[model samples]
Target: MATYSRNRLTQLLPFILSLLLLGLNSGQVQAAPKAELWPLWQPTVATGQSAVPDFKHWENFLSQYVRRYADGLNRVDYASVTPADKAQLKALLEQLSTTDPRGWGPATQKTFWINTYNLAVVSLVLDHYPLDSIRDIRLSFSSLFNGGPWEDKTLSVTGQELSLNDIEHRILRPIWPDRRLHFALNCASVGCPNLATQIYRVETLDQQLDAAEQDFLRNNRAVLWQPGSNTLQLSSIFNWYQVDFAANENQLLDYLQQQGAVSPGILSTPDLKISYDYNWNLNTDS
Candidate 1:
């Protein structure tokens, strides 16, 4: 009996050792050093600095590359980016990374972060273009830590390595607190807000934000009024950022109506059923 038990233990040992090795290699065990945590507030305006950084080059890139589809989805012509265009984008990002945003005002800071998020997304997709959806890019190591390309620490801004998630969640939403920001920061997904054909500017930030809200609301893809069920459906963005809509359904409806996202007739009905939906497909030109 002892001899048989010893043989059985020997047989199981190799299998158990293999499993442990696999866990370590997969980053599930023997954890690596933790990455730097994203900050709650990105560095904002400091005293005695210029108000707004020039965005002329960024505007030029957007004007040249972004196109509005008939379906209202703004698709980027990333496949056509030349070496010069890539160089220009790199230079712009480098400048943004090194520049301190502390002296900028609210409007300027808003525009700057919005542009940073959008441009960073474009740059990432450009790095792996020809893919069907942004979802295809997974920067995580294990399925346990699975996240989109947004998780990558692609930018070193103000001395801290930042990801798209940091730019969007930590900086933009908290700093601005304007729900219309959802319409300005494109996610390169079909359900996301349209990528503006022009760069966001501090001077025209309000108008641009208002226009984005109106444009998105006007599109059937964003606000679908189901006649058969007499229900109003909104983009999943509202559901995810419900707190941003003043933490109530009525406020969301009112805000949408205020932005002309839903017609008055559809919005007039009290106790209307609201559902949120989103599409994750790439917003490519069809």
Candidate 2:
């Protein structure tokens, strides 16, 4: 009986350990308090992609409203936007709503989604301007928990409503799986990747994405080396999306090195520990 039990235990150990790891990864072990989902994600289809989205209006909006600071932070002046400009913004959104992204090429698809997600966020913030941060704008009565505007699906497109999370997690990340997007999607927060000052064009999508990645990697928010303690601290993004970054710490380091964000000297250090951190404060113009 003892011999039989020992063999059974060994056989099940791997499966049991895998379950435990999965649970931990899913945040079941120490789950953060998340706001309740108002309405769950619904399936939506992109229209057949044909014409390139004319981002002229979006470009004008960015040039007029977004201010770039010396620290690489871009802030949108939601308060200062005139009524006529807002109309243009609305019309631009409406154009996107009517356009189908189904048959678009990868570049066109990515540009459309990224721009749509960003514009939707801006429109949300503008709807309730004068707030310190985007997190302050919560659903009716859901403000008790400090829930943000992300869950609210305020735009209708392709016969379905869309939210910031839906456009990002559901469509962009799942479809593209590009970690560089972590730097492209702005959360109207200082901790998030800086909002691009210019509009994203399908023609220059690769260059734009590469530039964004390089800029973020060099930023202190994404990486830090504490020579005093021999510790390398990475952005919480790597922690949250480790699979997208790499399979292990060494591979992550290699990725950073390849991006020219880190040096061989940092990689050569022994007995180093890794930690992750993020900031959630609003990225507003003071």
Which one is best on TM-score? 1
TM-score of 1: 0.78
Give the Cα lDDT of each candidate: 0.74, 0.73
RMSD of each: 7.5, 11.7
What TM-score would every model get versus the actual structure?
Answer: 0.78, 0.76
lDDT of 2: 0.73
- Which stretches of model 1 miss by more than 4 angstroms? 1-45, 48-53, 142-147, 267-272
Model 2 alpha-carbon drift over 4 Å, by segment: 1-52, 140-147
Residues 148-235, model 1: lDDT tens digits: 5666788866667888877777777766678788889898888888999898877888999989988888887688999788888878
